[model samples]
Each structure stands twice: as C-alpha cells, then as structure tokens.
Target: MTLLVGVDIGNSTTEACLAECGPDGPRYLGGALTSTSGVKGTADNVPGVVKVVQEALSAAGRDQHELAAVLVNEATPVISGLAMETITETVITESTMIGHNPDTPAGAGLGTGTTVAFAELGACAPGERVICVAGAGVDFEDAAAGIAAARDRGVEVTGAVVQADDANLIVNRLPTPIPVVDEVTLVEKVPLGMPAAVEVAEPGRTVRTLSNSYGIATLFDLDPDQTRLVAPVARALVGNRSAVVVRTPSGDVADRRIPAGTLTLIGEHARLPVGVDAGAEEIMATLRRVTPLADATGEAGTHVGGMLATVRDAMAETLSDTGGEQDAAIQDVLAVDTFVPQRVTGALAGEFALENAVALAAMVRTSRAPMEALAGQLRSALDVDVHVGGVEADMAVLGALTTPGTRRPLAVLDLGGGSTDAALATGDGEVHSVHLAGAGDLVTKLIDSELGLDNRDVAEDIKKNPLAKAESFFHVRMEDGTARFFDEPLPAEAFARVVVLGEGGMRPVPTRHPLEKVRRVRRSAKHKVFVVNALRALERVAPGGNLREIGFVVVLGGSALDFEIPDMIAEAVAAAGVVCGTGNVRGSEGPRNAVATGLVDEHAGRTR
Candidate 1:
C-alpha cells in the first residue's frame, strides 16, 4: 500500500486528506482542515497548501515523504479565462433571418403591412387596423408571449420583432412558413394589401406581388380585389432590385387563411442563444484543454480580440510547439455547456465561429462543441500530463476514500466567495458540478443591497449569520438561537456608529422587533434564497430522480460556517426527504476545510 495526500486550497479555508491506495482501491486514513494562509490563485497558494498538508500528515503521524505523489487542479493557485464583448450596435436589419431571438418582450408571429397605432400591441384599438406601439409598454418577454399567443390562436400577426437580444431563438418559436422578419426600424411602411401595396416601385413586376391580390390571398383569405386600388399595395411589397416577399397564404395551408396579416420587420436587436447544457462539466474540460483564464486576460485576450484568423494561427503555433502528445486526448474530450452571447448584429453572410476563440480563452466550462476546441488549444500549451476528472474543491478528499458511501452517490457543495461550486459524484467516476455566480461575496453584496448598508465587512457579517440590535442594553441576540442582553442600553448615537470594540467593528442596529425576531428573520431570509438555490442546483446534478434519492450531502467552504446556514439547509434538505449533515472535514472543523483536504485527496488518488 502507498500513502497519498490531497491538499484542497480554497479562498477562505484549506483542507488536507490522507489515504492509502492498494489492491483493494483507496482508503482514507486521517484528514485536517484549517483556515487558509493567504489569498487563493496567487503565488501565496503553495504556502497555504503546505500548511494544510502538514496538519494532515501530523494527524496521520506521518511525513510528507510517505506520500507517493501530489496532484492539483484549478483550485488553490487558481487558473481560468475571461473575455469581454463590446459592440457599437448589436441591432441590425432582419431579426428573423434564422438568427433572431425575441424573448418574452414580444409575442410570436409573422405580421406585415399594417398601419401604426400609438397604443401598444397588447392593447389594440377595436378594429382600428392600427399597429400597436408602446415605449416601455412591453418587455422582450411580453413581445414573445404576444407573438406566441397570435401564432397559437392562428391570428394574422406581423411586425418588426423585438427580443431581449436573442432574436433567432424568438424567431424559432414563430409559426413556420410564416415570414417573421426581425430587426427593422420602419414597421409602418409595410403595406396591408393591394390598396396598401400601391407604394411598390414595380407594380408590374413581382414587387407588386407583395401587396397584390395574390399577396392578400397568400397572407389572408381575402377575396381577390375587394378594393380595386390594390395594384399599388402589391407594387410596394415585391419591390424591384432584390426585395424579400412574403409568400401568399395558401388556401389549404391551415384549411383556411391563418389569421392572415402582412409580415413586417422592425427593431434593431441581436440574438443570443444558449446551446445544449450539461451543467458544469466544462470546468474540468477547460482546465484540461483550454488556455488559462490568466493567459487569456493578460495577453491572449488581446490576441483574440482582433482578427479571428490571427487567433487561428496563434493556436496552431502554440499547439505544434508545446502541446506534445496529450493533444489527442485533450481535443477528444467534450464539456457540457454551449453559450452564445448576443447573436449576430450585422449582415454576417457566413458562419462566424467562436470555436477557435473559445479554445484559446478556455475560461469557464460553457458548452460541448466550444469546449472541444478549447481542449485542442490547451494541449498545445501545456507540457504536463493532465487528466480531467473530479470536482475542483471536494474531489481531493473523495479520492482518498476507501469505502464507497453506503449510498450510491453523494453531493459536495463548496461555497466560496466568487463562485458557488457544488458537485454530485457518482461512484462510477462521473461527476456533475454547478458553478453559479453568487457565493460568499455575492451574499455580502446581497446583504449590502438588502440592508441599504454600504459597508462590505458589515454585509459580510450579515451574510455569514444574522444580526440583531442590542436593544435596551449593549447586548444582542446571536443567530444560533441565543440572546445576550447587555448591562446597559446602547446610546442612540451608537445606532449607525462603528464601534471598533467588536471583533469586526460591528455596529448596533435599531429594530421594530425584539432582538430575537430580527435575528430569526435575517437568518431565515438568507437561507430561504441561498439554501433553496443550492438545493435546486444540486438536484439538477444528481442522477437520482428526486431529492429523497440523494442519501447524503456535505457542505463546505466559508459560507457553510454561517452559525445557522448549515442547519437551515439541513432542515430544508430534510424537508425534501434526504439525510444531510454539515461537513466534518477531519472530525473537528465544519465547512471551512474541504478545499485543502481535497488537494491532498486529489494527489493521493482513491484513498477511501
């Protein structure tokens, strides 16, 4: 048997796990969790990690040499990617050119040739034949719903489709075969029928077909020429010089004209689409294959910001000169997320792929295809033999485990400052992780925002636990369900006063409720949002069909230490029918040490 150590270096805490791996697989020996020494993802990482490692070894009564090897992931000396997109104008003509995505703000439909109305589309004048237009009267969601309503009810709907940027996605929901033009400024000009079609430049040519009797017949079931002046409307529709024409409604299309109406293009909006998602699978894929976030932001971002072809050449050079043999493995593996930030803004004729950029940037685990390209580029940059597996923060400890959980799968959620990372590990080596934007720091931000307290440190305290006023005396109730009444009441001046006396310069609060109720509400409110979101994230990762299926879960990192946060979540999870407990990294500390312990576990491999 060989002894291995896993060191998990985190932003606020560090943990180490010791394990022995042999013929029977890996077995856990002892572990140590401690406060981290310094900021993570910096040159200071090694020292903090070393401290955790020593603690773990001391617990096991062993030395570092007893360890067989060491392994590290994107944690500790954290490495990643970043990219910025700024455009002068993201909106352009043709929102429905298969790229527009008008979400929610507008209803779904392909409407054309109607007079403009001052009122918004949702509230149209009865039979005014006027187009509804309202500023701030609707949102992208509103538009999408309206369009959808029109299409589902088979109404003649048309207009310049507006979306919250993802025009193509909105376009996808519209009635097929109906021309739902997106991105236009002049929606009113689109003529109604032949009487409206007269503006067409070419009355005799196909331009006239736009507002012609045939056009009306195509868009609506209107009898041929109810009004004789329709010649002009048709002329305006299919204008000479390569004009796009809405096909006339077919008599058999819907067994009748589909609430026939003209199709018009308006609003300058871009489309953004989120491709197939596989949660946070791409995080590992990225560290294994894409360029580091530092590299991208430091210098690589500049390179990719320019001509994409330049990025292509740079990728080739980096790969050929440095990637070596791991190229194939890195290139072949796929991550699970694909995101498109704000779609096409111009008349982009051909495909403008982000594959090469994503490969080079390799920051977050976004999507499958983009991640694959990132993998290829990553292989070319690194000389080390890298393998993509396990959670970034919790895996190190798990790797040292010798006995499988009596349960088939377990969830480990590591809450950090910048991001909240939760992973569900299947005994079979398959892991699903969810990396959300909010975590410890975000909690502070929320507290600050909620309390109207601009103080970061105060917000931090509120986030870690709950707060209550000292009331009549200088005493206050703690969130752990305890109260401390002071001997003397606080001076009114101390309300917002920063008293440097407390461990964290805490200030007194004035509340309408008793100290106990205030503490309870604060703690309860935080948990309601954070715990619920975390559980939902975990549920999405677990292969188990329901919350009850998850037999066990471990909570780690700074946020977990919230005097009542862990218990709050425990109760919440239990309510969902699962057995859950706060993490005991090495039998002492709770949520603070998973990262450091994980580091040791990662290097030591299957400790059990």
Candidate 2:
C-alpha cells in the first residue's frame, strides 16, 4: 500500500493528515499542527507544509521516504480594506456646525483671530486666530511658554484652530480677546500671520438670505448673498479645517489655501507609487485619487491624517517648488476622499511567492484582476500538473469531501483561514464554487483591534476559547450570554483581561474582562456572520431557488470544528429547511483525512 499525506496550510496555522490506501479503503494515521511557516498566498508554502507532514510521519512511527504521494491543499490570503466615502449631497446655507474627530473633521466655517497659547484662548478667541501646540513634538504644559517665546522673537501668534480634545484646557492662555473654537482638532489649519476673517457659507443661502449667516458673516463683513459664491469652497472643507473665505482690507475676498493631512508618510517601498517625478499628468491623476478635500487636516496613508508631519512637509515642498501648480494639484488630490482606518499589509507577496513546489504565484494590486494573480501563482509554484484533476482549490476540496459521496447535488463549505471557500457538487462533477474575502485572519484582526491587545497570542486565545468576567467573587459572565455566580470578588487586576474556561463553566478566564469580552464576542459574531453568509451565497448559486431541494452540506475546515460554529450553521440550515452538520470526513477523528482519503479513493473507486 502507498502512503498519502494531505496538507492544508491555513492563514493562521498549518495541518497535515496522513493516510494509507488499502483494499478496504484509506486508513488514517498521524497528524500535527504548527504556525504557518510562510505567507499563505505564495509558493514558499511547501517547506512549512512538508514539515508538518514530516511530524505526522514521525508520529506514526514512519519515515518520509515511505510516502508515495503528497497532496497539498491550496492556500491563498484574503486581503481586505475598509472604504468609506461621505458624499455631502445637501448643503444648508446657515448650519455651519459640522464636526468630526481629529482623524475625520472636514467642512467650511469662519472664526476671528488672536495671539494666544492653547491654554488660554477657550471662550474669547471664538472669532480669532488660534495656534495649537499639543502634538507629539510639542509640549502641552509649555504652550503658554512657547507663546511667550514667540512674542519675544517678534513673531505674531495670530490665531489657532485647536485640537478638538485639548480645546477646554489649552484655550485658557490667550493674551488677546480671542474667540476659541473648541471642536476643530486640526488647530494648525489656521494659517499664522494672515489676520483676516474666516467664512464658510453656502449656495442655497446667497440667494434666499438678504440677511445673514452667523458663523461665517459674524467674523467677516460678507453679505449672505456673497457667501453663496463660496459654497463650493465651504463644501470642500469637509476633510480639512484650514480653508475658508477671507475678506482682505480692500473688501475683496478669495478662498485661501490651508495645509492639512501634512503627516509624514512612511512606507515600506522606497519609491512613490504609480509615478516617480512630479509635474507629470500621472502625478495629477494620482492627486485626484487622493480624495475630495473634506477635512484638510489629515494625511492619506495608514489612517486619516496619516503621517501628518510628512504630508505637511510634502505639501510645503510641492507648493514652494510649483506654487500655483502645486496648489491646483492639492485640490485635485483632495478630490480623492479617503475612508477611515487605512489598511495596509507590507510588501511581502513577492518574497512569499518564492516557495518550494510552487510552480506559480501572482501578486496583484488592488485595481487588478485577482484571479489572474491566482492563475499566475499557480503556474509559477506547482509546475507539475498545474491543471491535472482540475487542480482548482475549492473544487478540489469539495472533491476530497465527496469521494465517499452517497449522493450528488451536495455542497461543501470549507471554512479555511485566509478566505471562506464554498463548492457545490453535482452527479456530473464539481459544478459551482466561489471564494470570498474575510475569514480567520479577519476575525483575528477584529480581535486585535477591538481588544487593544497588541498580543496576537492573547487574541487567538480569545478567539478559540471565550473569556468571561467574574462580575463579583461568585459570578462570572461567559461569551455566550450565560452568567456564573461565584462566592467572592475575583482579582481586580483580572477584571478586564481574558478569563480561562473550566469544567464548572468559567475557569479563571485567561484574558481580562472587556478585552476578553470583546474577543469572544467578535469571534462568535464573525462565525455566525460568515457561516450564514456563505450558505446564503451558495444558495444563490444553487441550480434552483429552493435550498430545501439540495440534499447534503458538508462543513469542512478548521473553523467547522470551532466550539459552536457548526451547530449554529446546522440550525441555520435547518431553518432553511435542509439538514446540515459538521462533516464526518474522518468519523470520530473529526473532519480530518477527507481530502487525502478522497485523493486515494478516487484511484480505488475508479479501479473497483
């Protein structure tokens, strides 16, 4: 009998299942688990996968050389980024009270100017210039001190747009009768030395109001009608705080340019994306991709106002070098609005593709075709038999699950690490299958983000086993909504960390409360959402509208074995009026061995 090893390398971990083909079918043997040896969506996968197989071999008291065939399941990473766009359709002429976070503030408005430190200009500088000095390189305590120093140097500290958070404390030190605006986080949006009026008005008002718009006209002598001309300019301020209408001593007014998102951008790649040199239309195009200038105070990478210092420096350099052209370019760039929480994974795909047994691997950009990249990666990595047995990933997994099939018209949902893949099998063969973004990694990411725990291990703990906070000494809360009562108060320190699970219900949850709670909730929620969504997606692709007509669904993959995911999915399927449950691909041993057994079974069933 020849030995067959089936290896599945998922995003978070790797697994190997060994089997021996005999007259009676395939006999399962050893298995092992390890952290993913390399990148999920690349060729460098063999070594890591091979290592797990070797462990399986040794555990079965066998040797690698005895292995006749090795079947490796395909692994591809699912990368996702959040995209948000706040398109302001309706513009009210008078309601200038638009507010957002430091990472999100945008829109037009007006204020007066005055020379004051962040600590003194609270209420008085409402209609004046405000300077902010509470960022990383600046001192919060010494803002007043710096103002004094600037006065000594004969530099006028004219105005300030204070960070929204620091407004209450910092606006107390203004020497002049300045009006301090509290909510504007990008206080630096207010340009220094340009002591003039700030006005954010609208189109709807200029015609209707023969009278006034308090916020903008309060500081400047602009009639409501004139303010309408500047409505477009005001609307553009949705992202930045610096740009507003200015009335010079000559009574002539123009929209002045202010700097925002000038954060220093630090990227892994040495070269700028798309183009190298400036002044080219390509750069202009790149600027347009930046966003409509909603909030002028943030940067364009990592997150809102990312690399603030860098964006500022670049904007300054671009302006100084090309002045008007640069300003025009900034507006073009501002047209490309950015959503919140910028997501980026470093440039590891290239190195990741250089793996053993990897005949092909493709690295595609966000704007490119993903399947082409998959095809490319496939050809580069698995040079041998890239198309043999219709070597597609999800389809093959279904084939593996159905080799022992009592029926056709069956669907298999393989919930793997990087992405959730589903395949429907018909009597003729594998018919429909699809790959969707988001999976274990996404769950882990949510855990990491929500828990604020930089520790992935802790996050993983939260995902696998939920943690419950012991509300008091005798009572503890579990992830599933059940509460356990205890005799006394648990340790205060462990109040918020992940807790441990035990026989009596909740053993001391390993993680603290809150974090533990967040992780557990996120993990459970993702499982429910993904499983239900996957089923719904599959049903849409079903031959007919009726899911009840479909016979069987085999849930395979690591996630299928999660504590409650399988049951939850079963209930969902039952609700859909169909029978569903975890795959008994390997009977008592769990969902293991299905792929390898099917691989060998295909040979035996055909021969028999």
lDDT of each: 0.42, 0.45
lDDT by residue (294-362, candidate 1, tens digit) is 122112233223312343333334333322331211111111212222333432221111111121112
Candidate 1 to native Cα RMSD, angstroms: 19.3
TM-score of 1: 0.43
Q: Give the lDDT of residue 129 in candidate 2.
A: 40
> Which stretches in model 2 have alpha-carbon errors above 4 Å?
40-43, 73-407, 446-461, 472-475, 480-492, 496-532, 606-608
Residue 315 of model 2 has an lDDT of: 36
For model 2, how does the per-residue alpha-carbon lDDT over 387-469 read when each residue is reduced to its tens digit? 12223344344444543443566777767654566677777775676554345554554554444455766555656665666
TM-score of 2: 0.48
- Model 2 weakest 10-residue run by lDDT: 351-360
The global Cα lDDT (0 to 1) of model 1 is 0.42
